[model samples]
Target: MKKHTYILASLLLVSGIALAQKENIKRANKLFKMKAYTQAAKTYETKERTQEVLQNLADSYYYNTSLQKAIETYRELFVKYGDSIDIEYHFRFAQALKGVKNYKEADEHLSKYYNKPVNTLEFIEANNKITPHNFKLKEIVNEGSSSDFGLSFYGENKVVFASTRNTENPSYAWNELPYLDLYTATLTNSNTLINVQPFPEAINTSLHESNAVFTKDGKTMYFNRTNSTRKKTDEARIAHIKIYKAELINGEWTNVTALPFTSNSYSTEHPALSKDEKTLYFASDMPGTFGSFDIYKVAINDDGTYGEPENLGETINTKHREQFPFISEFNVLYFSSIGHQGYGGLDVFRSNMVNGGFDKPVNLGNIINSNLDDFAYVIKEKDNVGYVSSNRTGYDRIFSFSREENPLTKYLVEGVVQDKNSKKLLPGALVEIINQSNKTIKDTVVGENGYYVFKLEPNKLYKIRGTRQAYIEQELEFLTGNYGKSHNIDINLESLVSVEERIHQNEKGELHVQLDKIYFNYNTSEITNEAAKTLDVLVDLMKKYPSMKVEIAAHTDARGSEQYNLNLSKQRAALVLEYLVNQGINKNRLKSVGYGETRPLNKCIKEGICDDEEYDINRRCEFTILK
Candidate 1:
C-alpha cells in the first residue's frame, strides 16, 4: 500500500509540472496577442522566445521608467545568449539600471563593453562629494488632492497648481473628461497650507491646467491646458495642448493667448521663464526627440510674442524623460529626469546656462530622491531652498530642501601673471597647477593684461597653472580649506628662458632674495635660453652680496613624477650654480640643492585637481640668512 501511495504522489508531481508548463504557454500566447509582454515575460520561459520577450518587456517597462524589471529580463537573456550576445542590449540594460539609479550594477554591466566607463564610480564619487545642497521641508504648498502639482509662486502669498479634486456637478463635464482646474493657495511664514481656491475663467476652463510659471514681474502667467480624454480621442478633432499666457490685470489674469509652434499634434506644458524673463522653456512630445519627453526653448519677442520653439538639445534633454524645467534669475536651470542616476524615481537636476546655452544637467542626488516620483521641482532665489511635489506620503505633496548659500558655494582664486622684467601683462599664456599626486590641478588662459581667475571648492588642495604658446608654463600650488574666505594671488610669471630676483638684507646681514618669476615647460628638464637671462640676474644678485651664501631651491607644482621633479630641480640648481660661477661669483657663495618639489611654499595636494588660483608660491629660489 505504501509503495502504491508513493507512485501516486510521483504521478501528481509530474502532472503539476506539465500543467504549469501548459498554463505558462497559454498565458504567454494570450499576453503576446494583447501586447503585454512586460507582464507575461516570466511566464514564457522558453529559449526560442526569451530574447524576443525580453526585448518586448524592456520596451514595455521602459515607457514607465521601470528599469528594475527591464534589467532583470535583459540579464537573463544576456546570460543565456553568452559571450556572443550583442552588447547593445547590455548598454540599454545598463541605461535602464541607471534610470532606476542602480549605478553600481549599471556600471558593472556597462564597464564590460569599454575600457573606460563614462559614468564610473570614480566620476560619481568625485561629483557626489561637492554636489550642492542642504535641504529641509519648507511647507506643504498644496494638499487634499491627488493632482496638486507644478506649484509656482506668482504673487506674494499666492501659489498656483493643477488639481483634479472633484468640482460641482456641471451640465455634463466639459469635453467629457475629469476636469483639471487651476487652484491657488496662500502661504504663511509658518508654511501653513490654507485658503486654497480655484482660479476662475481667467486661467482654468475645465481643461487641464497642470503647470503655471510667471514672468519676473508676475504680470503674465504661462500654464498648460489639455482637454484630455480617458482613452484616445478623435484623431483630427482631439483638442491639442498649448501654453497660454494671460496678463495679470489689477490682481486678476486677463487676455489669455496661446504661445505658438508649441502645439503640433502633441502636448506642450511645464513652462519656466528665463532669469531675464526674456525666454520660455518647457517640455514637449512632438517630433525630433532623443527620448520620450524633451525640453524645448522658445525665445520671447521683445513685444512679448514668442519666436519658434527650439529643443534644449542633448545637454539637458537626455534619451530619457526630461521634464519640468525651472529657470532662475541667475541663469541656473533645474529640471527633473530619470535619465540621470539618483537615489530613486524621477530626480531634480541643475545646470547653468552658459553663454546663452544650457550646460549639461547635473543630478541633484540622494538627499532629494525617494522610491516614489519626485518631479515638478522649483527653487526661488530669495528662498535658496528647493521645492517639489512628491508622493512620499502616498499622496502628491509639496516638499522642500536647502543647503548653504545657493546650495553650494564654490571658492574663487583671483590673480594676475606678469613679466618681472618689463612688468608687462602676459596675455594668452597657459597655466598648469598640480595637486598632491603631482598631477595638474588647474589650468587657465591668462587674459590680456595677465589677469586670470580660477574657481574651486574649499577644503581641497590645488595647483594653479598658466602658460602661453611661446613662454614656458608657470605652476603654483596652494591649499583652500574649510573657510568662507578667498585668496588673492599674483604671479610675476617670468619667461622660462630667464629668472628675476629682488634682494634685501636680512637680520644676520645675509641676502634675502625674492624670485619673482621662473617658468618651465610641461613635464620637462630642459632650460630655455631665456632662462639664462634670469639666472644672470641671480648671479648679479650674488655678486652684489658676495658675503651671502644661498641655496638654489627648485620646486614644482603638485603634478608630474615626484622623483623626476626632484631630479629636475637638482639639475636646475646645478645650472643656476654654474651660471653664477660663470658670472665670477665664487662657487662657495651659491649652494646648489634640488628640493625636488619638496618644501612647497603652497599647500597643494592631490592630482588632476582643477582648483585655487592662489597656489603660485610653489616654484621659486630664496636665500636664507646663511653664510
Candidate 2:
C-alpha cells in the first residue's frame, strides 16, 4: 500500500508541473499576440525550448532591436529545427547578423533564403559611390537627459523635440525608458540647444507625446499624444496613440483637440505638414494599413475640415513597419522602413512624387543610416542641412547633419571608340576598365555612336582598354584625382591587315608575320642582322597597341631528323621571345612556341622531298595575336 501511494504522489506532481507549463505558454502567446514583446519574451524564457517558444522568443528580441539576443535565439532555433523552419527565419537571422557586422555569415543565410547571391560589403561600397549626399552628424546634447529624439524646426530660431528626461514619469515596458514629453529649446547659431522646457499642462499630460510639426506662421501645430485611458483591442488592453491639433491664442497654445480620424482602437502618430499647410501627413497603424504602420496624407480644407486619409500605396509601404513620414518642400517623401533591403534595422528612404504617385523608394545609404533604428528625418532643401534621430548609441539621440553632394556622383569618364586610320566611330567595340590590381572593374560595348561612359571613384589609378575582332587593341592609363570632373578620351584601334601586307592568314586561319626568310645561320638559332630588322616591325606594332597579347611560333623545313628540327626551332623561338622582352615589352604578354617540321607550309614530309627555297619558306617566325 505504501509503494502504491508513493507512485500516485509522483504521478500527481508530474501532472501539476505539466499543467502549469501549459498555462504559462498560453499566457505568453496571449501577450505576444497583443504586441507586448518584452513581457512575452520573459514569459517564454521560463517555458520549455519547444519550436514554437523558440521562434517567438527570437522574434520578440528582433522586434525590440535586441540583435545580440535575437541572433543567439535564432541560432538555437536553426540548430534544433532547421529543416522544419520557415524561410523567413533565415531572412531574420541574416538581418541580425548584419546588425552585428557579420556580413560573411549574413550573406550565407541571405543567399540561401533568397536563392540569389547577396553581398553586403559590395552593396555598401556601390551605395557609397552613388548616394547623392554625405552627412556630418553631431549629437545634440541635453545635460542630465538619457534619451531624446524627434527634433523639428519650431520657428526661425527655435526647435521642438521629444525627450524621456523626466524620471518621475512611468517607465515604458518595451525599453524601460520613461514616458516621452514635448520640449522646446532655443537654437543657437552654433547649432546648440538651450533653455530647454516642457510644454504647458495641456500639451504635456502624464502620457507619451512626441513627433510635433508646426506651420510656417507658428500659429498652428500638430503632434502625437497617447491616450490617457486604456482600452481593449484584439484581446489586449492598450493605450493607442492619436494626433492632436493646437492653436496659439493670446501667446499661449490652447484649444488642443484630437484629430477626427483618430480612434481608441488604432494608432495615428508622427504628424507632418506641407509647406502651404494644405496637406497633413502622418503615420498610422489604423484599419486598412498594409502593415504595422504606413504613411498617410489628408487634405486640410479651407473650412477647417479634413478629407479622407489616403494611404501612400504599395510603392512606399510594405508588409512591415513604415513610419515617421516627412514631406520636404520639394514634395519628396522621406520615411523609415524595416521591410526594404537596407544595411539593417530601420533605414531612411526617399521617394519622389511622379505623375501624382510616389515612385520606388531609394535607401539613404550608410552615411545617414546605421544598423539600428534611424527615423524622424527632417530637412531644409535650400540650406542642405537636416536633423535625424537614431538609437545607434544605445539610446535615442538627435543628430544634425550638413549635407554635401557625393564627389563620386559627379566624377565620370566618357569616351568614343574610333578607327585609327579612317577616324570613324568603331561601333560594337569592347571597352574595359581595369584597376591597378589587374582586376576588371567594368566592361561595356560601345553603342551606335561608339560612345561609352562610366562613373569613376576619386584617387584611383585605372587602365581603359578598347578592342575589336579585326583591330589591334589599345589601352590608356589614367587617374581620377580631380573629382567632379569629366574626362573625354577617344580610343583609336588600328587594323592589323591594313598595317602590313605580309600579315596574311595561313591555311590554319592563323595570322602570321610572313616576313622575308628570318635567316637562322645554317644549323644555329642565332638571329642575323636582316632577321633583326624584320622583328622590329613586330615590336613597333606591339608598342602602338599596348593591350596586344601575342605568341611567337617558329617552324623548320622538313630537311633534318624530326627530333633535331624540333630542338632547333624551339631554340629559335626562345631567342626571338628574349629579344622582345629586352625591348621593354611585358614578359607576361608574350609566349614562344616551336612547331618544328610538324606544321610545314607545303606537303614536304621527308628529308629530300623539298628544294632549298621551298624549305626556306617553312623556316620562319610567325606572330599570332592571342588577345
> What are the root-mean-square deviations of the candidates from the true structure over C-alphas?
20.7, 23.5
Best by TM-score: 2
Q: What is the C-alpha lDDT of each candidate?
A: 0.67, 0.86
List TM-scores for all candidates, in order: 0.53, 0.64
Candidate 1: which stretches are off by over 4 Å?
1-124, 138-143, 167-179, 227-240, 250-252, 392-395, 405-409, 412-627
Tell me the tens digit of each residue's lDDT in model 2 across 284-334: 998898867989999999999999999989999887789999999978899
Candidate 2 regions with alpha-carbon error over 4 angstroms: 111-116, 189-191, 229-234, 410-627
Instruction: Please provide, for model 1 over 1-627, each residue's C-alpha lDDT reduced to its tens digit, 9 standing for 90 to 100.
Output: 999999999999999988987777666655544445445554554624555566655655553355666677777777776566676666677766766667788787767755466564565555565565546655464555654567787666687777667555131222222467777787666676579888877677756677888776888888887644432333213455777888989877899887767564777878998877788889887789787788888888898677878988888887778888888766688888766655445778888655567666666655565644678888776667656887556455776556553224456678888776777887866666665556665677776877777666566677776654323345667888543457877776554234423655446544455654666555555666777677777676556544546777666666767888788778777876776688798887778778866776655753465353433456555544344
**Which candidate achieves the best lDDT against the true structure?**
2
What's the alpha carbon RMSD for model 2? 23.5
